[model samples]
Target: MFDSLQDKMESAFKNLKGEGKLTEINVAQSIKEIRRALVAADVNYKIAKEFTDKIKDEALGSKNILKSVKPGELMVKIVMDEMTTLMGGQATGINVKGNPGVVLVAGLQGSGKTTFSGKLALFLKEKKSMKPLLVACDVYRPAAIDQLTVLAEQIGAAVYKEPENKNPVSIAQNAIAYAKGHSHDVVIVDTAGRLAIDEVMMTEIRNIKSGINPTETLFVVDSMTGQDAVNTALAFNDVIDYDGVVLTKLDGDTRGGAALSVKYTVGKPIKFASTGEKLNTLDVFHPERMAQRILGMGDIVSFVEKAQDQFDEEEAKRLEKKIKRNKFDYNDFLQQVNQIKKMGDLKSLMGMIPGMGKAIKDIDINDGAFSKVESIIYSMTEDERLKPEILNMSRKRRIAMGCGHNIHEINMFVKQFEQMRKMMTQMSKGKGMERMMQQMQQKR
Candidate 1:
């Protein structure tokens, strides 16, 4: 996401490498490079300068206090703290708390507002245990209602839209009333967007906000717009005074300017970040976690949270029993793969692990990587899926033809699956660790 900025920041830290302590000379050299990195990431030069200046002061002030810490490590700590503060020190949650909490969504054209509306509905539905009504108030664009309807269908949320009603304010008010009658606890009103800032769009959005009296108003912006995104946010805030910001298209070639500068310029916390096109890819923005990722320190906590979301306690217990009995078959394997897919894209999930981002930066890992294995599993009959040992040579050949894979590929997959099942059984029985210790002692 911020690959270029991450590389440049790494280079900046190299200046302090092998140094005994932080000095004015080395600190200035590093700060200059840090400022250059921020500017290259499309951050405002003025904000970058002020940001690095704070880092310089912090580094110099703590030079002697932490003599035991390495020079490079100390500088990284100082910069991480400053960057977290620059990006709104903590996560700010949206207020969806009312009889029927209303959220007003605003942004420029092509900022993914409608998509985010659907994602927000799914997030609230799955995470917050609240029923969210997706209100399609974007009456300007063609088929905008249909798009929202499709998204709402995907998330299984109720959508309120007046196909013939052009008045957004009335549509929003009516949507809230509908939500109350339908027992929807939250209402997300997706409003129209403009190609550029204009009075007409502003007035329409202001009127909608006034009519709905939303518990929270969010300004969604395309993060790939760089500093222009920040400027647009400021313009919108001046009009409607949004409660928070939402950064979309964060998985694109974003230079990190919008995320780094929006809070400082618009005086609003970034409430959410849309990493991928998947509705499940929405994340609550955490400034400290983001700073760590920008500095090449992966967000392990977020990775765990994503996994935990897909985790089912009863399913885990069943799978554990199966593995312990060496009964983990194609069915179990397929189920595990589906759960991982629900977490997010493989590349993004890996990026959340510590030290995995740079390792996989150049690798072309995606959800497609699972297609071959899935095809193979899908080719198997229900009986074959439930029983691994029943696959004979003839059965393997038939399955290979069904899955469009070669016989050798099917054989290799079967062999690997058996090995994995055996190892899991052994581990569950406490024999795997004991065997590993014996092997180590024998090697010694």
Candidate 2:
């Protein structure tokens, strides 16, 4: 998401290279470049200036304190610290601690307000084990209610909607009472959004907040809007005085000015970030991890957390036994792909690994590749899937016709599968890694 900004920041740090220690001239040059980069990313000019000025002061102050550390490295550390503080130093949790916690969501139309409501419901239901009731208070649009209903159905959460009622305040209050009666611990009130900020919209949302007295009020903003997002957030905060901000559409936000400037401008922490359209793509905002990401240092902590979330201890044991016996077949391969799909988008997941983001920046890797393999595997018979070795020339041609692919594609897939199985078996035996490295070196 911060691809351009990352590149510019790297260039700024490179300007300090070959310098023994931080100097006024070198620090000023780097600071000017950093400020330009931030401004080009759509960050407010004043905010960028202040942010980089702080970095410059820190750099000059620490010149002799850490003589052994490289100037470029020290400058990076200083900028990272300032950026973290600007984005709200640590993560902030949503306030859902009431008997029936009410979280009122307000945003502009098409800001992904309803989608985020669904994601938040799913996150709470699956991760927090909370019974979240999705309240469709966006009574202005009939489609809004239907959207929430569909999302709730998919997430396995209850939806409280009064389609006939046009009063959002009444609907929100009623929904909270319904939550209390249904034993739902959390009530997420999805308020109506307008195409632009207007008095009517602002008053309606403020009234809803006052009527429900929600434990947390979040303003959902589209990060793709750049500085406009910051302005909208501030306007909303002035009226509703929201507890936190939810930045959506971050996967499409290349500049990332909203994430970097929202907290500093609106005086609210970005509690969560919604990336892709997937219901499982919502993540709690971590400023330090984000800073590391912007500086080309991948967020390994977040990467591991996602892996642990998708990890199945019992499934791991079963897969380990199968791999040890060389019994991993197409079915197991398909299952593994499905599990990885649940982890999030393939490209974004790779970006979380150290140095992998830049390595695959221009690569077009998508789930479609996995889907092709799945189609091939699904075309196979039960016996063939269990024992891929049974597939001969006739069997491959038949499978190719079944999956609508060429016989050559089938042959290549089968050969790759066999090689993968052999490699995995050797690794399980603790002898393949060294031999594999030797073979790789020889090929090089």
Candidate 3:
């Protein structure tokens, strides 16, 4: 995610931790580095200065304090606090409380507005048990409606679109009416985006707002736009006065500017973050977790919550039992891959573990990593998946040709799978080892 910023922040904190006593010169040096790192991360110059200035003050004021805790640890606490404050300090979730609650989606072109809308609808429908109706308000783009429809279908959410009606306001209004009639509890109107802040775009969104009177208006901005995202968010907030901001494209090589400064700049809390194109890749914005992530520490709580959401409990229990019985095989491996996919992209999953993000930062990880294993598993018959030991040299040769892979590659995957199976088996059979492993992965 913000790997560079994380590294720099950790380095800055390192200046304090190893020192026996905090000194004015060393603290000032660390603060300077911290400011530079924030600037490099695309944070607004003014905000970055103010943030570091706060850290410097805190470091100096609390000098020679907390004898048991290192100066660096205390500095980390200060930086974490200031970083969290800059990013809204607290997690403010979307307000979808009204009967037939309304959520208005607004953003620029290619900001993933439509996808976020669908994700939000599905989130409310599946997570909150609310019947959601997705209203397509982007009448200008011919494919916008279809894109929303495809996403809605994938998530099993209902859609309300009018290709014949060019007016988004009327469509949104009528969709709410339809939702009311059908007992739908949530109506999310997905509006159009502009290349920039234009008069026509603002006017159209304002008209839609006036007509539907949404319970929550979300301004979706692409985090990859860097400081430009903060500027655009300001413009949007000035026009529609949105309830919250939704930062999209966080999965990209975003410099962390928008996330770190948008709320402070626009004076609106970021309610959600869209990490990927997948419908289940949305996460409620949390300032503390984000600050921890920016500081190079992993977010295990959010990661486990994501696993809980995407992984089936019954299936996980079954796999755990299989591991305990030493029956974890290619079938279990395939199931685990599916479970990971259900969570989101491969890189995003790796990022959940603290140090894995740094380790895999430059690695070209993709679904291709799973391809050879999947191919080998598919090459095997059902019985082989159940019992992998049956594949001797001759059997492995036949399986290799069937999957169009060399024997070496198949053997490599099989070896990794075997190692993982053994590890899982040992952990499951040991007393309270699985929890410890989970904690270790969470820390990593």
Candidate 4:
């Protein structure tokens, strides 16, 4: 997401690439480039200057102390630390620790407030094992309740809305009561938002917060808005004093100034970040990992966390047994694909690996790639999928016609599937393989 900023920061660090040590001349040159990069990303000019000034001091202070470290490496470390501090030093957990925790969400219109509510509901329900109820309080917008209802249904969460009540504060208060009596452990009240910050919107949200006394109040903003997002956060905080910030549309934010600057400007932690439209695409904002990603170092910790989140231990055992018996067929392959899909977008996930973001930055990797492969497998008959070896030339032609693909494409897929099965079968029985399986099982 910080692609442009990463590129610029890399260029800045290149100034010290061949320098044996961090000198004032080289450090100042690099700092100047870094300052320009931040300003170009829409960060406040004063904050950018102050940030680079700190980097200069740190670099100069470390020049003689760390002679073993390369100047470029030392500069990267300095910038990463300062960036982390700018973005709230560490991850902050949402306060959901009440009888029925009440979370009041506020933001501008089209800031993805509703979408984030649904994602948060799903996240709390699945990850934290909390029964979350999504409350629709956007009474002004047409069909806002319906939109929230659809999202809640998709996530298997209950929606509490008073379509006729009109008063958001009343709707929020009633929703919390309903949640308490209905076993919903968390109540997320999605308040109304305006196209821009205005008194009416602020007053309504402030009243709702005063009425419900939410355990946690969050202000969601479109990260694509750049510095405006930070200014909006300040306005919301002045009235509602939100506990944290939520940065939405982060995947589309190539410069990522909002994420880097909001916390610094508003004095609040970025609680969550919404990358894509998928409900599962919401992530708890981790400043350290984000700094690592922005520095082109990748975020392996987050990558593994996503993997473990989607991992099914019992299912893995079943698949391992099948592979050991050379029975890893189309069905198993399809199931594995679905599991990966659950882990979020392929390109974004791959970017989490160390050094992979730069490698595939220009590549277009999407779900459509797997969809083509899935369509071919879906066209196969039960027997053919279970035992692909039984497919003759006539059967192949029929399968190709079914999936709207050519015979050559079908043949290529079959060959790849066979190769995968053989390799998995060999690995399933290799030395220390059982130990690896046990370790995976233990994680569950």
| Positional deviation of residue 67's Cα in model 3 after best superposition, in angstroms | 1.8
The lowest-lDDT stretch of 10 consecutive residues in candidate 4 is 431-440
lDDT of 3 by residue, 367-413 (tens): 57778778889999888888988878888898999999999987887
lDDT of 2: 0.90
For model 4, how does the per-residue alpha-carbon lDDT over 1-444 read when each residue is reduced to its tens digit? 789999999999999988888888999999999999999999999999999999999999999998888999999999999999999999999999887999999999999999999999999988999999999999999989999999998999999988889999889999988998999899999888898888888888889999999999999989999999899899889998899999998778558789889988999999998888899999999999999999999999888888888777778778788888898889889988888999987888999998999999989988676987898989889998898789889999998899899999988988898998888888888834567768656766
Which is the leading candidate under TM-score?
Answer: 4
Show model 4 residue runs off by greater than 4 Å: 432-444
Q: Highest lDDT among the candidates is held by which one? A: 1
Determine the C-alpha RMSD for candidate 1 after optimal superposition of all C-alphas: 4.5
**Candidate 4 structure, TM-score to reference:** 0.97
lDDT of every model, 2 decimals: 0.92, 0.90, 0.86, 0.90
What tens digits encode model 2's per-residue C-alpha lDDT throughout 83-133? 999999999999998989889999999899999999999999988999999
Model 1 bad stretches (over 4 Å): 431-444
TM-score of 1: 0.96
lDDT of 1 by residue, 1-444 (tens): 788999999999999998999999999999999999999999999999999989988999999999899999999999999999999999999899998999999999999999999999999999999999999999989999999999999999999999988899999999999999999999999999989999999999999988888999999999999999999999999999999999999878889999999999999999999978889989999999999999999998888778777766667667777877788999999999999999987888888888998999889998898899999999999999999899999999999999999999999999999998888888979866446434434443
User: Clash pairs of candidate 3?
Assistant: 16-72, 17-72, 354-444, 355-444
TM values, all candidates? 0.96, 0.95, 0.93, 0.97
